[model samples]
Target: MTLLPDPAEARAARLACRQGAPRPTAGMAPGFTQCNMISLPKDWAWDFLLYAQRNPKPCPVLDVTDPGSHRTALAPKADLRTDIPLYRIWRDGVLAEETPDATAAWAEHPDLVTFLIGCSFTFETPLQQAGIEVRHIAQGCNVPMFLTDRDCRPAGRLHGKMVVSMRPIPAGRVAEAAMISGRTPAVHGAPVHIGAPEALGIADLSRPDFGDPVQIRPGEVPVFWACGVTPQAALMASKPPFAITHAPGYMFITDVPDTHWQV
Candidate 1:
C-alpha cells in the first residue's frame, strides 16, 4: 500500500517542488487543501467566473474570493495573499513577472478578486491508490501539458483553446485509470481522449507546450485530460488588463478532502 504523506509534509514537498529557491513561511499550518489560484481585477471577475462555470472540465471552480479580500473563506485559516509558494503576474495577457508572494501585488490593486480552482492533486492520491502511475511524479518533472486544438466554450471576453496534461498508462489498465479519475469531476474528471496523440493535434510526444515530456514505454498508451492551465491560455487570448495564477505546480493547499470533490 502507498502511504500518503501527512498534509504538512505534502505542503512542504509541494513548496520544494517550486521552480527555484526556498522561501520562508509565516505560519506553517498543516492539513489544509491546496488549490490552484487565480486573481483578476473586479472588472474581469464576472467573465472569468462565467468562463469557469461554462467550461467545467478545464476550469473547476472551488471557491471565489470576495472583491479585495485576501482571505479565502473556503479554505478558512488559509491566506489567499501569501500561502502559495509562487505566483505569475500577468499584464495584458502576458506573463510579466513571477513572485514568491502576492501580498504586495494584491496591495497594489485592492479591488482584485481571487479564485481557487480544484487541482488534480486532490485525485492523485486515489489514482495512485488504484495502482495507476502518474508519470510526472515518477520522473520528478512537471506533467507535460499541451495546448490542444480544442476550443473552450467562450464567455464574454474569455476565449481560448483547451490545455491538457498527459500521462502514459499501460494499455491494459487504461480502463481502470479512467474509472478512478472519472469519479472526481470537479478536478478535471475523466480522460478527455485516450491513445493517438495526433487526434488532439499533438505532433511530437517528446515536445510539449508546457512542462517536460515523459517517456511512454512500450505497451503504454498516452492519456490526456483537461488541465487547469486552460484558464491561463484563456487569459492570454483574452488579454485581460491584469490577472494572476499560481505558478505551475505551486497550488494552494485547502482544508477540504479529495473525496468531497466526487461528482
Candidate 2:
C-alpha cells in the first residue's frame, strides 16, 4: 500500500514536488486540498470561466489567478509553475511537451491565466476514513481516468466530452462511498456513475485515456466521479492555440484544509 502523505506537511510536500519529485499526488498531502490546473492565454479566460461555470460537476472552480500572475489565493507561497509534479504544454490543441518545470511557458506568455479546479482526490481521505477502499491509492499508482461520451455544456470556445476518475468499491459500500464524497460539492461531490463502464462509452476499464488503470476486484463496482481533467479533453477537441495543464493524476496541492470544504 502507498503511504499516505502527512496532512501537516502540505508545504513540505509542495516543496518536494517543486524539487522535481515525479510521483502522482494521489494519497499525497491527505488533508490538504489538491486541484487540477489549466493555464490559458488571457483572451481565453472568459470563455473558459463560462465553461467551468456551466459545468460545475467536472469543472468546479476553486481559485483563478490574475493574468500574468503566478500566485493563487489558494496557496500564497506556492509557485504554480513549479509546484505541480508535472505539466503538459499544449499548442494549438496539441500536446506539445510534458515538463517538470513550466517557468519557460509562464515567462513566454505573461498573460497566461491559471484556473484551479477541484479534484476528486480531495474527497479520498474521507472515503478511506469511512472504510471505503480507494483502489488506485491502494494499488500505489495514479487513479484511472477515462473520457466518456457524455457531453458537457459549452461556454463560448470551450466544448468537449466529460472525463471521470474511477475507484472500485465493494458493491455493499458503493452508496457509502458516494455519500462520503458528496459532502464536499466543491471537490467533485459524488459518483457520477456506479458500475457499467460501457454505459459511459468507455470500451474497457484496463485502458484509460489518462492515468494508470487499477484492478477491479470481483465484488467491487467501478464508481466514477466528475474529473477536473475534463478541461484537457476540451483542449484536445477545441484546439486552443496555447495552454498549460497539470499532467493527469498529477495535481497542485493547496494549503487549504480538505475539511474546510466538507459539509
Candidate 3:
C-alpha cells in the first residue's frame, strides 16, 4: 500500500488542493485523518454544534475554529479557507456554487465559524492494514455515498435524513471490517447497516446522492456508515441563509494522526 507520513502528507495534499485543481482526498494521506469541514455564521453555530452533539455518529466533532478565523487547532499551519480540495457555498440551504477555496465566502462573511468533523477516511487506513480492499480507492474514484431514510435529530432549524457511504466487503471479512472501524468513534465509527440498500431507501447502489459509485462485486456485502454528508443534507433541509462546506470526498487534511481517533 502507499504510505505517506502524517503532517507532511497532509501539508502536500493541502498544497495540491489549493492549486485550484480540486479532487477527492481519499487515499491521499493514508494514515492522516481527513476531516469534513463546515463554516457557518455565528448565529447558526450553536444550533449546528447541538446538531452534531445530538447526532454524534454522523457528525462527530473533531475540532472547531474560533469565529471569524480560518485556523484550526487540528493543523496550526493549515488554512481552513483554502486547504480543502473543494468548497460548497450554501445560500439559504441551497448549494450556490462549488469552488476550490472559501476565501471569497470568508471575505464576504467574516462571522462564519468553522467546524471540523470526523470522517470515515481516518479509519480506512487500518482497514487497509487489515487486508481489506477499499474498492473506490482501488478503482480511482470517490467513495459512494447515499441519502438514507433514517432521520437525524433536529437541533433548532437543522434537520434532515442521514447519509451513508457504502463499501463492498467480502462476506468472510465483514466482521474484521466492523472491528477495525468500530474502534474509531471520533470518526464515523462502525457500519450502520450491512446488507440491504433498499432498507435505507437507497434503490440502487450504482446511484448515489454524493460522490461516485463503485462496483459491488459478487460475493461482497454492502456496508454502510453514517456519513458526514448528513450535515450537508441537513443544511439543505434547514435552509440556513449562508454556509460553506467541503464538497463530498474533498475533505480537509489535518495534522491529527489516524491513531489519535482510535478508542
Candidate 4:
C-alpha cells in the first residue's frame, strides 16, 4: 500500500493548487476521504437536508455548518468559507463564477448554511488496496460524471434526476470493486448499477456531462455509481436564488477516517 500523505501536507498541497502552485501529481493523498461541499441560505437548509436524505445513494450527508457560521466542525478545524481550493457560485441555477474562495460572496449572505457531502475518495483507498486501479487518478484527469435518467425522490423544493460517476474495472475484478465499496455507506456506498451506460440513459460514454472521459479498455466494463454532483444538478433544477458548491475534484478533507464511515 502507498503511504498515506499527511493531512496537513495534503491541505497545504490543496492550498498551493488554489494559489497557482505547480500542479502536484494527482491522487498523491491516497487514503483521506474527500468531500463535496454545498453552501446555501438558511431558508433552504431544511429542504436541502431532506433532499440529501431522500437520495442517500448520491447525496451522502457528512457534516454541515451552523447557520451563519463559517467554521466546519467535522473536518480538521477548517473554514467552510475558504478552506476549499475552489468554489462555484450559482445564481438562479446558472454558474456565475468559479473562484478560489467564497468568503466575499458568502459574507453578503449572513444566513447561509453549508453542507459537506461524502465523496468517492473514501472508497477509492480500499479499491486501490485491493489492486483495482482508478483510471482517472492514473491519467491525471477529473473523474467523469454523467446525468442519469434515474430520478431522486423529491424533497420540498429539491428534486432532480440522479447524476453518476463512472470508473472502468477489469472484468475479473468487478465484483471485488463492488464489494469493497458497498461496505462504506457514508460515502455513496456501493454501485447503484453496473455494466451498461445506456441502461442508465447515458447516450454516449465519451461525452460526459461533467469532467473528462477516460478510455475504457476493450475488456474492461464501465461501472456507474451515484455521484455527489446530484445536489448541484438539483440545485440547478430548483434554481434557488443563490447557492455555492466545491468545484468538482476539489473536495473538503474531513478529520474523520474511512473507518469512521464503515458499517
**Best TM-score among the predictions, by candidate number:** 3
User: How far is 17's C-alpha from truth in model 3 (Å)?
Assistant: 1.3
Task: Report, for every candidate in turn, its global Cα lDDT versus the true structure.
Answer: 0.78, 0.93, 0.91, 0.83
Candidate 3 whole-model C-alpha lDDT, 0 to 1: 0.91
Sort every candidate by TM-score, greatest first. 3, 2, 4, 1
Comparing 1 with 2 on lDDT, the higher-scoring candidate is 2
TM-score of predicted structure 2:
0.96
After superposition, candidate 4 runs with Cα above 4 Å error = 1-5, 21-28
- State the lDDT of candidate 2 residue by residue for 1-263, as single tens digits: 44454555899889888896688999888888999999999999999999999999999999999998999999898999999999999999999999999999888898999999999999998888788878889889999999999999999989999999999999999998999899999999988999889999999999999999898889989999999999999999999899999999999999988988888
| Candidate 1 structure quality by residue, lDDT tens digits, 160-223 | 9998888899999999888888998988889899998898988998998977889999999999
**Superposing every Cα of model 3 onto the true structure, what RMSD results?**
1.5
Output the worst ten-in-a-row residue range by lDDT, candidate 1. Answer: 22-31
Give the TM-score of each candidate: 0.89, 0.96, 0.97, 0.93
On residues 65-149, what C-alpha lDDT tens digit does candidate 4 reach at each position? 8888877666555677676767889998889998877888898799999889999877887888788999988888888889999
The candidate 4 region of ten consecutive residues with least summed lDDT is: 17-26
* Model 4 per-residue lDDT at 169: 97
Which candidate do you rate higher for TM-score, 1 or 4? 4
Candidate 4 local Cα displacement, residue 121, angstroms: 1.7
Superposition error at 150 for model 2 (Å): 0.7
Positional deviation of residue 24's Cα in model 1 after best superposition, in angstroms: 17
